[model samples]
Target: MINAYATLASLVAFAQDRLKNEEKGATAVEYGLMVGLIAVVIIGVVATLGGQLAELFASVSEELPAVTTTTTTGG
Candidate 1:
């Protein structure tokens, strides 16, 4: 029982040391989280404005008059 307890204590200490020393994976995870947050913000802005923009363009197009052109040939 004593040996088992000692092994568990060492294992816990080793895990704590490893966690404190590790940085490479943490940086990659942080970068991924930042990118995900930016993407969510962009999607939200676009979704909110998309309908308004489409309506504005539709109104503008309705206000514009169409133009027709004819060509004449000289003999």
Candidate 2:
């Protein structure tokens, strides 16, 4: 009836007010945005350094097998 409608309207209004008064979710949202931005920057830096890093690791890997074989034979 009318009372039920009134109660629902009041509940909706209360929920709207509570949402407007909320600050906890806003902080988490800001942190999420900051993390997303940082991730994008990291992705950009890694992308830029990708080729150089690959070559460096390749050279290390190539030398590592040789070093390991020499050490094993020497022992």
lDDT of each: 0.61, 0.70
Among these predictions, the greatest lDDT belongs to 2
- lDDT by residue for model 2 (15-61), tens: 56757896344456545655665676677679989999999999999
Which ten contiguous residues of candidate 2 have the minimum total lDDT?
A: 22-31
Give the per-residue lDDT digits (tens) of candidate 1, residues 1-75.
Answer: 355456546655655675689743345655565566567667767898999999999987776543212222322
Q: Give the TM-score of candidate 1.
A: 0.42
Estimate the overall C-alpha local distance difference test score of candidate 1: 0.61
- Count clashes in each candidate, considering only residues at least 3 apart in sequence or on different chains: 0, 0
lDDT of 2 at 50: 100
Off by over 4 Å in 1: 1-26, 60-75
Q: Residue 22 lDDT in model 1? A: 71
Checking candidate 1 for backbone clashes, the offending pairs are none
| Reference-based TM-score of each model | 0.42, 0.64
Q: Report how far residue 34 has shifted in candidate 1, in Å.
A: 0.6
Error of 1 at 21 (Å): 12
